[model samples]
Target chain A: MKLGRHAFGDDEALMMAIVNRTPDSFFDKGATWAEDAAFARVAEVVAQGAEIVDIGGIKAAPGVEISAAEEKARVVDFVARVRDSYPGLVISVDTWRAEVGAAVCAAGADVLNDAWGGADPELVDVAAEYDAAIICTHTGGVTPRTRPYRIDYDDVVAAAIADTVAYASRALSAGVARESIVIDPAHDFGKNTFHSLEITRRLDEMVATGWPVLVSLSNKDFVGETLGREVGDRLLGTLAATSVCALAGARIYRVHQVPETRQTVDMVWSIAGRRPPLRAIRGLQ
Target chain B: MKALVPGTLALLPSYASIEDPVAPLRAACLDAVGRLGPRVRIVSSAATGGSGARVGAALVAAGGGTVVESGETGVLVVGNGSATRTEKAPGHLDERAAAFDEALRASFAGVDLELAEELWADAACLRDLPPLADAEVLYDDAPYGVQYWVAVWA
Candidate 1:
């Protein structure tokens, strides 16, 4: 997949490495929380096989609370540094605020990965204003960590599918091209494991919606339960899960272990093959 | 599929209490993976934590994983559909119940180990795990374990 027509193309699956610059983030602890370390990791991921890098200032993750201004600052510092580190790299800022989105785009972010399904209209405005490619997420039936209510859904796949389509429609209306828009069926965002497994098992169906997809299933508990391993020992599980995502039709993968996941994608692509099917049905009769 | 270190599996009673390791660990484990990057897969730390050396020893005994206390979130923040939920028990039962029962019942040869508790939602509150301060557990009978899904075709 080539982002923004700069001749930047991923030969196989494009791995989007995460560079979160936040204090309360569950992962990273203190490792790569620093600007220099974040910058270095970005380079390493690219060198390892990441086609793109996603840097977020504030943790947009569930149960996290951040004011817009603070979000902007968090994104600005690391994104700015990373942007400077690699002029040719495809950098993205994971923010839903239009202001922060705009600031990051101006600061050198190439894409906007919004987890809010564009619920923040300003985010769409920012994408349009900045002329940056956007990744519109559909967090169907997600259970917000901070909110006081519990989330319940009867048809998770259907709901998520609808959410993405609806959100994409909004993005299209906002001037995001069909090709430039990518959809993510937010796993763990709200759905339970049953729903998550159902979605994953039926991944091809999710891909059929006529848009590129961004999958973030790294080191997550889903893979952990499968292997009965601990959170710290999820490397191989992360790789396998990423492989499944790639095999299922994910164009972009947001990951923690960049090099290894990239390599895994390459290996699977060779074995699984991403060849477009023969078009006998469309051939001149 | 090795679990992501510090990754959360399901919201178990062990980690469920507002003040317990289950709730907080869920957040912390997610962060660990977020920090560890995508290569590390996560498992349910609700049972993995609070067990202290037992959890670490189990992980070490299982031979190829690390263990830690999960915080308030998960790396994937999945819908619990992607994971394997166990019967509701405090963060103490996951692996213990299985082997505990397995050892006692394997001798019977025909008997299957009974699950300690049915997995549940926040609303179930079957066990005596503390509640999340002002928070409610929502669907009490929600099965344990949920997965954070990847992108798929529509």
Candidate 2:
């Protein structure tokens, strides 16, 4: 997959670390709200071998409205600074606003991670204009920052596949490079706990669609509901889900913990015969 | 012309790791195999399973050589020393392993077959080959607690 300045092999599994710029983001909760703190987070994940840094200006959950101006203010300069500092790092901005997407792209962002499932129709145009990658996601037609209350589907996996594929088609029609487009089943955005779990179980169907799958199964509500663990205690559950996705051939992982997720995916990738052991001399000596 | 290489299963592609543990050994084996010309015969130590034959074929194929049944241009022999060389070796440190390897290294033509079998040494094919006193030794070491040698005689 090509992310603007970088191209990854088909056999590679990439780690996209979450770097939230929001003061009230659920996981970090004002930890990286300061620009310096967020920059430090970028450096830390980079050092931890993350290939991508997903910088988000607004929290996923509902809160006081953040205008596009505020979102651009939060991420544009930070993305520029990170771009200048780490030219090899894939910079992705997690926003649903075309204005924010274009602004960040101008500031050297490589990917527009539309976590709200293409809420802004022009986001794809912005991606094509800037020659940036776009993550087409399935959010069940819900508005941005809204929780999934009373959201039901005949088959959640089918809905996710249909929506994400349609969104991918839209991105393709908008002239987004085929290699730069990625599909995501936006877990917990328009999905309840059970829907997210079902999506995880049937993730291979999404993978079978032939669009590279990006899974944001980080410290989300689904893992919390499954293990009854709070936000800070969901690393193990997230990695377990990540292993399932990796086995099913998810290409990109949007994660909070890079090292743990990388180990899990590498282990599963090797088991699936897609990757070789790093240094295997145990019995073949 | 003829060459000898270790019967290391790690040389096979199926047993390959991302970081090859036997890179230098592989390089030596390939270099020796390349010198065996285009049409060569493989004289592997093991009569059953064909492990040595597989390694020979792979190395020959990689060196742009073909295996021929008769009228061969060169010979590729596959054999190795004892697996019980060190305390952490695969055979768990047999006391006679070092001396057995030393004897075979000096000359494999007159090895004691019963003692070689007891030490888990793969030298049956090497026993029939001539001495390596005048041959060019490409590699000689035991990186993985098991001794390996790559040599060529033109």
Candidate 3:
């Protein structure tokens, strides 16, 4: 399952755990971002089968400052602490800032997971400069409180791929190669729950884009809305969403509860990959 | 009043430059369960094969989940992709319908398909047009017949 600069074996769907150092992140508030919390959580989630640890500072929930320099400084300490603490781990720095990306790269971060489809075009340079793998996720406007679930595109999957391709083209123009990048359909970023469901439903189609797929639907608000529950209560919904992601050919899953999501991904992957390759298609349906 | 069949869910319609009927399937499934009960699950199951029998055979080889019918709240949403051709008979669908139908299952999302949502919950699920009989025959060609993965339940 190795995608770009990162590596995830096919033993199961890759389990990338969330280690939010920020106080306002939707889940795991101040739990793992603290220096002490980092040490404990790294061991816990890694031991629980998290091959990748995504550490981030600040919360991108709605209405937060979307400033670049602020994002960089917040995670500088995060990257330094995690990279130093987990010498052998694959650390993914989650941000949409080139400066933050450059800083994390300076601190030994192995990958960059951008919520925007390389939201910062300059991120391509940072990724290339740092020799790190970059996962270009789908991005749309944020309404922190609500996740819209409707059809902006008659086919969300196609739009996702086209947007990703355009982003990839931009990254390529910026000197990032195909092997250095990955793509996500921007699930829940600009979508409501139903739209998120549609993204999940049509994921395999996105994989057809050929970039490795990194799915980060861990306990997101869409799951919260779909299950008619809150973040903590949406574990089952999260598991189901992960299962669907795995089955839909997502190579990576960004989740808060690594152990459980990893187990679920393994089960679904074990069942899905043994057969023929996933049928590939185009456009949105 | 449209149905999305399975192979259609594979982005075939997208490849063919068609609109996937997933939203319509969502609409149809909601309508079916709303008009009936709320236990039915809408699963956009995807599979590949040439005909219903062929795809159904592969689905069996690949393994099948539940048999969907119009009982209380059991029906498979004919799957994804854009509208291709139009036909007006039961089982008059393109090749993808059978393949999608074979692989459909329940959503583990914990969604009570039998229930409705506050938003976009008023969508309808029509098995066939006035001229078409079975959902299978009319896989494509409806005014809003975007394909989806087949939906199934107990």
Q: Give the TM-score of candidate 2.
A: 0.98
Whose TM-score is higher: candidate 2's or candidate 3's? 2
Better of 1 and 2 by lDDT: 2
Candidate 1 TM-score on chain B: 0.20
Model 2: pairs clashing at backbone N, Cα or C within 3 Å: none
Instruction: List the candidates' TM-scores in order.
Output: 0.59, 0.98, 0.58
Model 3, position A102, has a per-residue lDDT of 84
Q: In model 3 chain B, where is the ten-residue run with the lowest total lDDT?
A: B115-124
* Model 2: native contacts recovered, as a fraction: 0.87
Cα lDDT tens digits for candidate 2, B1-154: 9999988888889988989889999999999988888999999866326688888888999899999997899999998888888888877889888888888878988889888777777778898777777689999898877888899998
lDDT of 2 at A226: 91
Chain A TM-scores, per candidate, are 0.87, 0.99, 0.86
**lDDT of residue B33 for candidate 2:** 89
> Could you tell me the TM-score of candidate 3?
0.58
lDDT ranking from best candidate downward: 2, 3, 1
Worst 10 residues of 2 chain A by lDDT: A276-285
Predicted model with the maximum TM-score: 2
Each candidate's DockQ:
0.01, 0.84, 0.08
